[model samples]
Target: VSGVRDKMNMLGAVTDDGERFIALTPNQFNAEVAKHFLRAVQHEFGERLVIILDNASYFIAKTLKKQAAADGLLLEYLPSHSPELNPLESCWRQLRDGRANRLFLTLDDVNEYLSTALPALNSPQIYEYLC
Candidate 1:
């Protein structure tokens, strides 16, 4: 990943209703970025949302939890080692497949690739039943 220093990192979520939202950022992924992305998700979906999360440390950060709680959003954690239970897991796989062994010359090149790849991923068939 360091090979592409200017490459973007995405923080994304997929709803049970099959809507996808993404935020592009640089390398660092911490509490602040997670909280900010959560807020964006909340704003787009509404504060009554319940977000399902994996046990990533930043996703479970105290401040992020507090903010979500205060905002009337529920944070639900999946059991550890349960990537199969996360709908985003499949989407991530396809995303990785799209970029497999490719080298982008610049951040713009990456974004251009994403511009096409993401919309192709928008179909409902990409998600699995998480129950």
Candidate 2:
């Protein structure tokens, strides 16, 4: 027997003031992909940004550090083993549990669900996690 499998990676952030963003990728997380997400956040905020993050290697990569510096962004890593301190973790949990116990026929179907479901995650209620 065989089972179909697909992989999706997301880079997400929530500002202390309630702005939130998400980028979906087919490839694994790395400095290059991280640079893209940082650029997007910079584009949206158009000001110096401070992002609290977990200790993912790519998040601390020299290349990504240079990109953030050039873009006037700050990357702050959370304490080890402290996922609860990162607001984005709550966002992911919400997204995952939002679709639990459901099935999709294709990756596109899943993307479609996310396209709609993700915005729902922007509600003022969820923004509380950032505070």
Candidate 3:
């Protein structure tokens, strides 16, 4: 081990049909991250995106809503305490399963693994999580 350990905050989203989008951040989820995610999705899939999120405080921020509206995006909040309604949660579970028992010397190592691992979710076998 290099004796270097770091905590990386990440925001991720999955499409209803199994595509994955993720971002690594130095801090917790906030309006900035939320806006970045919105813009990233819009840039990837074009305008008029509808993103569904859990009851995370940042997702409920008025500033975020305003910014999303300005970006021609829509934000939908899932029912409280009902994680099963969000298909992205299953995608995260699969990510956790894939990373289980792995050891990383640096955050980049984890990020690299995730970069490869995430796309695997597009495969027929792993794609079930989004269905």
Superposition TM-score, candidate 1 onto the true structure: 0.88
lDDT of each: 0.84, 0.80, 0.76
Question: TM-scores across all candidates?
Answer: 0.88, 0.86, 0.81
Q: Model 3: how far is 61 from its true place, Å?
A: 0.4
lDDT of 1 by residue, 1-131 (tens): 65536758888888767789988888588999999999999998876988888888989999999988998989999999888877777778888999999998888989999999988884344345553
lDDT of 3 at 13: 72
Question: TM-score of the candidate numbered 2?
Answer: 0.86
Error of 3 at 78 (Å): 0.4
Positional deviation of residue 51's Cα in model 1 after best superposition, in angstroms: 0.7
Error of 3 at 41 (Å): 1.1
Per-residue error for 97 in candidate 3, Å, reads 0.9
Better of 1 and 3 by lDDT: 1
